[model samples]
Target: MTNELTDRGQERRDSILDAALTVFVRDGYHATKLTDISREAGCSVGTLYTYFENREELLAAVLQKVQAEIGNASDEPLEEDFNRISYADALRASNRAYLVGYRANAKVMALLEQAAHLDEQIYDHRVARIRRYIDRNRRVIEQLSERGEIYPIDDPFMFTTALSVMISRLAYYTWVEGFFDDSDETLERVAKTIDDIWFRSLGLKTD
Candidate 1:
């Protein structure tokens, strides 16, 4: 009985999140109301509030879910075996995984892109998240520097900040701008762009 009830609760939560994604992506953060989300979720406003504290809280939850999905989709390892991976190969793998993930979560990417224009908090949230991800890969940056694959930068943090902005711009364009035709060509172009930018930035020889 307890297990059945728990499953039902999980189902309801997922239903709310699914509905919220549609509403938030279509109407955006500022314009979407709790009542709107409630109706979409097939629940009453009171029930919606029972699960979320407020609109901001609900938006945070939705963003969290989107981030989690993107993270999972981007989880391709840098190597078949971690100890055997070259720095260049790891960088290429990471870039490829990120583009794949962004494509998979294009809707959330679109919503965030739109929301950032109107909300400073949303913009800052994205910047902070990018910083956090870069920080997690500090060892990779350091390794590249030690091998002289990248220029010796005194500050990895500053290097990552600038590099992240460039990479983020490319991902945004590829995922949101519709600049490339929907084909293998587009994917190949994105991957190559990522590789070229990182290679040039790190002072590596490029093809």
Candidate 2:
């Protein structure tokens, strides 16, 4: 929907999306208003309408932006050559990256979960998005097994799904629910624990 905008127009649209995210995180999706976003963006409600047809469209755009940021945050680990690095190190790096991304988007992710319960479309999108992560990681596990870097698994897909769910729940509790302090020490401890699980489950040597 934003394809035809000039560079300045696109910038304005991006600002609106950022503002929407801030407001949504602060006041929540159901409680947020276009005027709140406009105020945060230092624009008028009319200007917001210029970028988005309604509050729903604006929110969807904000959600898309958040999703993109989260995706980018963890992409670096995927590009690493596992042959050059130990599998345990790679898994630790990947887990830390994923947790960092999840921590950054924690509030918005929680908001997304709330929206999912109320909106079928959001629910479906959330489910599909998680499945995509599972599928991607399952492929990675299969490749690592084929390379004989990890033990052969009878059901890599299910195993990946389980690990993904465990990590996701840990992130939700640690970040969204504030189960632990957001300290570097805490992050390191959590990452190491996750690494240990992955290494043990895959029968990879940790030392």
**Global lDDT of each model?**
0.74, 0.81
RMSD of each: 4.1, 2.0
In order of appearance, the predictions have TM-scores of 0.79, 0.88
Superposed model 1: Cα runs more than 4 Å off: 1-10, 146-151, 203-207
Off by over 4 Å in 2: none
How far out, in Å, is residue 115 in model 1? 2.1
lDDT of 2 by residue, 38-153 (tens): 99999999999887888777777777777767766665677688668765666677778888888878898898888889877677778877887787678768877887878888
Candidate 1 residues 84-143, lDDT tens each?
766667667777777887877777887777776776767777776677667645656776
- What is the C-alpha local distance difference test score of candidate 1? 0.74
Candidate 2 lands at a TM-score of: 0.88
Q: After superposition, how far is residue 107 of candidate 2 from its true place, in Å?
A: 1.4
